[model samples]
Target: MNSKRSTEILVGLFVAAGIAALFVLAMKVSNLGDFTDDKGYEVVANFQNIGGLKPRSPVTMAGVRVGRVTGISLDPDTYDARVTINIYRQYDNIPVDTSASIFTAGLLGEQYISLSPGADDFYLEDGDVIDLTQPAVVLEQVIGQFLYSTAEGD
Candidate 1:
């Protein structure tokens, strides 16, 4: 009887470990497991369209993640998408003239912001606005244009 009880206890512990592992996996896949305590500096960029970009999307420079998107809103006057990015304080040397563009990871994957540094003596500071920005490319619009052009040619 004691051997049977020990086996049952071992099975219960195994099930609990599996549950904890699944919970951690879910957090990582959802980007909610970001354990960094870097409060970072905030910067703004304006775009005409921001496809599927959401808060917590990665901000990358040369394919390296430097920050995350903290907020996204619309400009009441210009009607453009205003994106707030919080760049890690360790990357405080980004130039003032750096340009930001939205890019997708794969054919139909998550969107992120990529920064291209420019030749400027000035470095971006908190509350600085990046004027040079490019909006995300909508695949539907591109396909529509391609189809129209092909039909016109025929």
Candidate 2:
């Protein structure tokens, strides 16, 4: 009886450990584990259309993730989509004239902001605005245009 009870306790511990491991994996996969101490710096960019960009979307530079989109809102006066991004402090050398473009990782993957560095003397600072911006290219629009052009040619 004593041996059986010890085995049961070991099994319970194993089950609890497995559950904890699964919870950690889920949080990491969903990016919820990025609760670091660094608050980073915020920069704003306006786009005419932001298709499916969401807060917490990745902000990448040269294919490497450098930050995350913190907020997205509509500008009432300009009627444009205002996107706020928090660049990690380690990537503070981004040029002021860098261009921000929305891009998809795979054919139908999530949208993220891609930064293209430019030749500029100054570096981007907190509360600065990135003026050179490109909006997301909707797949539907591209397909429609292609079909229209094909029919027009025929």
**For model 2, how does the per-residue alpha-carbon lDDT over 28-96 read when each residue is reduced to its tens digit?**
675666655477899999999998999999999989999999999999999999999999888999999
Off by over 4 Å in 1: 1-36
TM-score of every candidate relative to the true structure = 0.78, 0.80
Clashing pairs in 1: none
lDDT score, residue 59, model 2? 96
- Assess candidate 1 and give its TM-score to the true structure: 0.78
Best-fitting candidate, scored by lDDT: 1
lDDT of each residue in 1-154, candidate 1, tens digit only: 9999999999999999999889878786755566455687999999999999999999999999999999999999999999999998899999999999999999999999999998999999999999999999999998999999999999
Q: Which stretches of candidate 2 lie over 4 Å from their true place?
A: 1-33
Candidate models: Cα lDDT each: 0.94, 0.94
Q: What is the lDDT of residue 12 in candidate 1?
A: 97
